[model samples]
Target: MDHNHQDPSTGLLTKEFAEGLGQFMAFASNQETTLQMGKMYCPCPICQNRRFGTVRGVWKHLYSRGFMAGYKVWYSHGETDLMVNFGSISQQNNLDEVGEQQGGVDEHIGNVQMVEDRFRVEEPKFEAQIFFDMLDAAKTPLYDGCRDGISPMSSATRMMSIKTDYNLSEDCVDAIADFVKDILPEDNLSPATYYEIHVSGLGLPYQMIDVCIDNCMIYWRRDVVRTSCRFCGKPRFQETRGKSKIPYKIMWYLPITDRLKRLYQSKHTAEAMRWHGEHESNREISHPSDAKAWKHFQSMYPSFAFERRNVYLGLSSDGFNLFGRHRRQYSLWPVIVTPYNLPPSLCMKREFLFLTILVPGPEHPKRSLDVFLQPLIYELKMLWDYGVEVYDIASKENFMMRAVLMWTINDFPAYGMLSG
Candidate 1:
């Protein structure tokens, strides 16, 4: 008969269909919270120090605190398994610490430095595979449709691919090495300027984001020459032009105006006033007129709104060109930056971290590396807010990885300092 018919309001269906639909809705609504409950038992030192007697207790505590409350839960078997592995490692480390403290003879005073050193010796390396697993677990099933051994695209991979394609060269393998040599800060090749590179172009842009330069060496050198984009397939070398020379700098200013507009639009005038009051009372303001000046700026720039978007930097040996315009492959460097010092309310909080990489372009009478690197200034500001201590740059090329590791550890003074 005519089974497709349905009521307008309820959209009437057969009893079986209605029941099935109800089941689906319930599953969808509770999915995230349910999955969060399953994998909330993290064994990190931060969680372990909470005096939870067991792993299960930690999980329960996280749930009670609503750590993942209202967050959409995405499940990945690999991620859950990885979390378990990390938790086990953390637990073992904790046990080791207890053993060290208890076994010491001679009524010993607890050496804080020794304890700190032991912890660093035990800390797990941040593996890309683990990160990929985390991202997978965080993504929903509907979006995780790839086959076995394949996971979803990441922000890192996508940016790298875009950058690679924009600067495609048959000699990219060789070019990157030369590029690294040219950007070396001084000739010391210290760890401060280490970097890495990756190339991919087969997937969706955003999903392909991944770090190419994990760690590489940087050395001191002043005479290195930048190369033009050979991917453009033209004999003429072209340099990056205009505001494009520093895309990051132009985008940085946009967020400031954008934040002010949002504050005005949300009618957070009283909160704004309170912030000013707090600023004055706390002496957070550099000058007495700073508060008034801020309010005035907000009032005048009511339409100011910063659109947070990804900024990709691609250099063509030929010149910068959009992806579809060229037939030949070019090497592209996708530089991603977040607007600096965004209001706390607009930040990702726990996961917000910023990184910047500098790639020198071929020197030409027309373009300057000074202009090229200017955009990164704003990115540096954002990184500061996130307490980023380490920078992985590849310019002068030695000890890049070690420097990054040191920075990651020492930069957050609250966590303790990194030693050479």
Candidate 2:
């Protein structure tokens, strides 16, 4: 946040702070709850809200000492918005990002939780934490004075891109961040190091379910117990966070349910997702709607076709060597799913092609591939039967959105494996 910034023209407090000060005084005017009955906690640098002052006294302290650095979030006041975790929340963790001479540690769970604790009324589950992170990151500006519409999440993504494109080291990234931060205005928004920028949340969410090392079976559903593989009797174990060994290797399952919901949430693609239903494609076979299978499925299940927003999806899988041709002898199988509801061009676009599952392999699973597909299949069933609550952007209404897997896109070997 922009702390201690002065308006160049007036040589006084920034427009934001000056404006906020008025609101703070107004709120304190009527509210009886404060550091004292007739006084509020002084948020100025001299008092740091630990000292109480009358409205006039508080104003004088702020005018002389300036508001405490990074006091954008009014947590002491009655505001409990998600962004209130900023500035003071790190008091429970490290505060080097606020320009402490001792330097800063890399961003970690402790630091995150310390900030997050300020906003939580009760203990949040894993999903709730993720939701808050995603929400806050999206709402937060890239920096205090950012006007480009970029956010911290987008900034982290761009940093990742540059790091990969140039193969920069962590130290090099730190140096670059330091240089950029030095040149930029003095604000808490620009992190000093790449480590400090720690990007996380729903940006990359994938389930790591236990799987049989031999790909014989996945340790899911009723088999969540059992110390060994059901089919081959091979031991499946991995160390948990508590250092306890648990059965099963791993298979990455990226759920498509949330991705589908986001399609309707975004204004950019919400309209495009239903383009096939709204626009006339004629009989020219430009999209999947012009194909026989799409029409056949619609005719057979008119109830499913009744909702124009209901998604039709295509599932595809392929196997490829993980280590190019000759370095390491290992393969990887990736299962991708795409919606057929989009126009032909967008349907094939990389952004829309969702990779739902990754079946690990020194070799392909072959007939055992179904073992890794259990989660995807379960989610698909849920989408078809129960559906999910979604907010449509174009219609500006909530609806129960359903999805159906129309067909599979795969080579002959994959097709055969799936059938088996």
Candidate 3:
């Protein structure tokens, strides 16, 4: 059989894979093979939704068609690649540049090399040291505007307080920016630009998913294709605050896979994550990783413990009142994903806790937790079944990462909802 050059789950293609497909398609067209345009050309048995806007369509077609169908189509048409083989998923190593077989030992070696080349992403070239160096060079002029020796961060602090804490309008930002510039003329950066620089690579950006106001279902994946809530028939976007414009609710999806990948992206964080394993301690008390439950679980499931780098996460959630001392309080639920891979001292830190899901509400879904947690459940199920491909910074190689939702920590009220 043959394999498609696309990710099975996402149908994402590399530039190299897309270009190769384009060349093969051009070759087939030259040989008088009739090619259909748009979605009509897709050979997938499950779907016919491929569009001709870009290579993404080609990726979708190849992925949906699967190995067997795509192979039959290529072989029957007598299409060939002088430098490639499609007979097997592992054929990336079977042939040399001229499509000829190498030796058995050489094939194994080549396979490993090919896997590394395909998955290994070099560390980002931008160094934090460079950023600090630039800051050091600008420090003198940054503090030059100080009359009575006010700190430079004072201006930034005031700006953040006004924008985030006070929830000021956009028009206020320009005036704040002007005031900050007057104080530090050398660093005359706008508030927006400064914010971008500060948060450029702090964490993985989140995805927004539309959710039903009734807490019945979230419009994600296949559900997203529809305009209205499947369960309640309510419009995906609802009028709120006595206005006819704003969306009623949205679920912010920050996946565990993406968050773990960001940990590997930074050299410092990658090393820091190994502190639990590397620390020298013979005393009875320290980190949660040192506890009996943690050790026993690892002993029971030795496979999970084989890779010390594999992450263990804890789930937590609670409902809180967004408005205090009000006639009608807005109830908001936030689901927090905590990485237990960090040392005990840092594991529970505010900065390390990732807000994976933010359930907006004027009222909490007390008993309807499962319905609202549909998207998270789906992601967890997929992670357990297929796992995620992640780079192992400690080893400087790629590995399949499988994270366990070790435990759930919630209040008594939330416990019943989450457990039920």
Candidate 4:
């Protein structure tokens, strides 16, 4: 089937998009929603009475109803109504008191007012309204002015330049904050905190945890909050100026599932994510999804291909001197995870690279990596077995997303430690 077709005007379906959609539909059929029908079924409201056997069907369903314009209307109004109702309720209480003072509070009048108030207050009780609203508003025009792309000058624009051009330090951020105090009050966010808030605004935030100095384990849940390392029995915090303390190493855990869902929430990224499944077929050396091994794997393990959105990840870790080997002996090991479902061209982009764990080191984790990898491994396994419930912005429905750690990427020098 010639699934790839690009509109001259909108340029919606390129080879990449077609390939991604085809691939997604292939696996989406295995999901519970579609599996029973033995054909791809779109849950979009427009497709309520229709069934399609191709990726084009899925694409059309999402394009037409996925953005949820109706849902957004209801959402914005509902929020406005709630705020209005709050003020109204307060006003009504005062009026009720006034009526009682004036001896105008007949029992029937009181009962009528009470009933009217209940109806007004309970009018916003359309549950699931917010969820649908969020889905509708997520990638809307509101994001364009704030974070879409680099503009000539804006708070976001300046922050981008400061981080890329200048030293990424607390003082640098503070200075920028001072510079833009009138225009945009940063409220003295350290660079780290600023980045955290920035990403969180996009619906992705990272969790930071202290790790064992020996790289033997991470100081995580069920392990004394800030006591000695459970495995090595070494103090979790190091002595500093007087009573001040600092962690020896830190581990950052980034939730993979939510971020993956965010990909679908945004129009551009969501389309780009389907690149792998949307690319032209019957071609050699096009993309990773076109590889023989990928097809063979799909054929061999059909279960893994059940969810088109299920991410296949590649993990990589290596240690490098913090300040060139000669200047300082200190080293840092950053563990990065990448989503391979995106087109190969985009799969390795810095934006798609996720920093899951940061292992501070004077030496490599070697042999101790297993201990530090506990959290990631546990999450991956749970994702594969149980999966996570994620909303589909296009289909206007929720589905389970399962992910797999397809492989690891590391240099020859660090291969032995990270491999097994």
What TM-score does each of the candidates earn? Answer: 0.20, 0.60, 0.55, 0.58
lDDT of 3 by residue, 1-40 (tens): 2345556685455455554544444333323223332112
Off-target runs (Cα >4 Å) in candidate 2 are 1-140, 145-150, 159-186, 190-200, 238-248
Q: After superposing candidate 3 on the true structure, give the runs of residues whose Cα lies further than 4 Å from its correct spot.
A: 1-161, 178-203, 239-245, 264-268, 278-286, 325-327, 381-401
In model 3, the Cα lDDT at residue 95 comes to 31
Candidate 4 lDDT over residue span 1-420, tens digit each: 223244558645455644433433333433443445344544344443222333343444443333222322121111235544453233333444433433431223344543443232111112234444544544343223455532222344356566768667756665654555444323322223345324424344577778877876777777737578666689888888877768887866776766776666555675565566546767786766788877777667665564566677888988888888486687678888888888877888898898877766777666777666777888888998988766554544455678877778888877877645
Q: For each of the candidates, give the backbone clash count.
A: 54, 1, 0, 9
Task: Evaluate all candidate structures by whole-model CA lDDT and list the values in order.
Answer: 0.28, 0.69, 0.58, 0.57
Leading candidate by TM-score? 2
Where's the lowest-lDDT run of ten residues in candidate 2? 98-107
Q: Would you give me the overall lDDT of model 1?
A: 0.28
What's the CA RMSD for each of the models?
26.1, 21.2, 16.5, 18.6
Lowest-sum lDDT 10-residue window in model 3: 98-107
Clashes of 4: 9
lDDT tens digits, residue span 1-420, model 2? 236545668556676765555555554434435423455666766446544455555655554445788776665554446634542343323223222321221122243553343232323345434554587667787667788667766666677678889999999988987887788666635556777665533455677888888888887779888788878888888657877786545788999987888787666888788776656766688888877888898778765664668999989998998889788877799999999888877889999999999888787687988878889989999999989877665554456689999889888988998963
Which portions of model 4 miss their true places by more than 4 Å?
1-179, 182-203, 224-226, 240-245, 278-280
| Candidate 1: clashing residue pairs, number | 54
